[model samples]
Target: MRIIRLSVGLLMLAMVGTGCISKKKYDALSKDHETLRASSASANSNLQTCQQNLAAATTRVSSLEEQIAQGKAAITALQASLEKCLSGANQGNVNISKLVDEITASNKYIQHLVNTKNKSDSLNMVLTNNLTRSLSREELSGVDVQVLKGVVYVSLADNMLYKSGSYEISDKAGATLAKIAKIIMDYKDYDVLIEGNTDNVPISKPNIRNNWDLSTLRASSVVQALQNQYGVDPKRLTAGGRGEYNPVADNNTEDGKNKNRRTQIIITPKLDQFMELIGQAPKTDGTTPQQ
Candidate 1:
């Protein structure tokens, strides 16, 4: 009986030990399931946050692409407008340059005309004054001293120059020619033309064949006297004869014939200086032509 009691005690002890071990293992399993549940909930939260962030990023990308396309279109339009503006500006510059050239040319032409007129008027005034001052009142009345077309014409009666039907210059004419030479010598830039005119009455004499010969000889004689007798320059003198033609009055009347037989001395200014000024080109600095 003692052996059976000890074996039964041992069996009870083994049963109690197994029950405690089973309880401990069950507690550990419960704790491990709770930890796994917490981890799964945290993971699901993280995935939802990631999906929302992806949606925001996609919206921002679409907006940025639309803005880029609009910017490109605006840039293209601006380039086209710039090109058009440049083209218009270039054309306007060309037109302005052409207008400036035309205005400059017109101004040059007008200035040339004004300068020429001024020079002519000034020369004519000087010639008229000098000729009028050189002669006496009685001499001026007998001879016509007039300025026509910038030239001085002195018309003297035939009685002042020569005798009837004679080609020789008289003493009175020589004195008059010497007075004229004084005025002529003062101005070297003048050209002198001595013209002799005669009536239609025919004449035949020694050393004179016809009225033409008489008139020609008279003009030559006056020219020679002006050069040799006075100090007049031979280079500036010219002799001309108009016989029976270009008469101032009718040759039929004696008084008219006498009036027709006259001598004309024409004095003209040289045009070399004026012509040289007109021939020059316009200045590059936009100034007037040189005087």
Candidate 2:
């Protein structure tokens, strides 16, 4: 029995003695596993950074697109405005571009006759008010002939003719009227509006009563001169009279009153293009003009 126990103990001792493992090989395997885990962590961090950069780049691209859209819109608006302006000027010598560009939605405004307005701006700058035989007192008075707000405000005074109550465009006024007539004849293709006005003084004549009648007659007479004498286009001509209502200055002063009583010959160019810019159609002859 002792011999059998001794044999079993010997066998256990030999198994324990032979159970040897290499420390260097186990440590190498452990190091390889740690390196693999670190590499995986680094790769994940790089992927997160790449996603963040992509998001930032997308935002920048979107901003640039917005700016491009705004610029296109601005360019479109300006082009439309410029086209409309040119059209209005082409219609008449009385261009009111400044008025159109300047006047706001606020109520302060003057009357705008549609047919007359379209014709007021377009001109070739012909007959630069030089000859003594055909110019108004204002034109001869070192006047600067320039367009303002698109209206060719012809500055003239009634003192060139008439003795405060007369409608006869005096013999002295002939030289001035002749030059103007020549200009009108030269631009026969244009439209014309002869407007007459009078001071605040009450005018009650046997034939002409009130300032309205006097103003109307004066305007009519001017129209007749243009149409009959110079052979201006009657279709392009119109006469309107404003007694004391359409004053440009204070009637309390003599100079102011004179300024208000003067006549205006408005010349207009073609207006088809101008009307289109404003989303309207140019009024052809035989149709009632805008007022």
Candidate 3:
């Protein structure tokens, strides 16, 4: 009996020891699982960052490629221009270095001219917009404003400006003329040329001998009105005539004849300033080109 009791006690102690060992092993396994899960999360984060960096790099590369393509196209155009210039140069005993220098200077001068043209175009566009905006719909009914080759042209129908077959300004056209005068006064640097045009129809008025005389008188009337009544500078005003010679359309039809009989107010930048800009061409050797 005593031996049996001792055996039972040893059995119970062994079972308790086995249970403690199993609990310790379960705790260790749980810790290892958590460590593996944290490692996987860190790796995923690193992968996402790398992907973002790659995308940014791709965008930068695309921008650089486009810039390179534009540069190549510009180089090709410049090469073509240079080749054409060389072909036109004197071929016999040509000084290669001096010719290259001259070509460079010519290129610079061409660029200068292009810049000047762009500036003049901008000015003309501004002037046209300002005039169009300031004039009311009724005032602009028989008027056409346009910018052509860096010049502003305001074409007014003869019926709108003068009495039929006469050089006298009509009473109803006063308001429109006043608005135009204000615009002209605003652009103090620009000069105004009032040009009169006529159809091919012969005129036998008391004072008017022919179309030429009528056209010139019509232009003079507008010029005088602008200076005398509207307070426009006399020095900036010029009067001219184009009688049946510079027709805008065929004079055979009535509509065409009506279109041809019109007055044009040509606005241009001062010639002195423009001539000065042209005279100041750039030299290849960092000097100014001779006038």
In model 1, which residue pairs have backbone atoms overlapping below 3 Å? none
Model 1 misplacement above 4 A: 1-113, 271-278, 281-289
- Stretches off by above 4 angstroms in model 3 are 1-101, 282-286, 289-291
Give the number of colliding residue pairs in candidate 3.
0
Q: Can you give the TM-score per candidate against the true fold?
A: 0.60, 0.48, 0.63
Error of 1 at 65 (Å): 29
For 1-291, candidate 3 gives per-residue lDDT tens digits of 345445545654575667754656555655655565567678778889999989999999999999999999999999999897877675533667666777777877788778778988887888888899988998788999988877899999999999998999999888889988999998898999999999999998988999999888999999999999999999999999988888999999999999999999999998987788767777556454653
Best by TM-score: 3
lDDT (0 to 1) per candidate: 0.78, 0.64, 0.86
- Model 1 deviation from the true structure expressed as Cα RMSD, one decimal place: 15.6
- Candidate 2 global TM-score: 0.48
**Model 2, position 202: C-alpha lDDT score:** 92
* CA deviation > 4 Å runs, candidate 2: 1-139, 142-146, 271-291
Estimate the overall C-alpha local distance difference test score of candidate 1. Answer: 0.78
Worst 10 residues of 2 by lDDT: 104-113
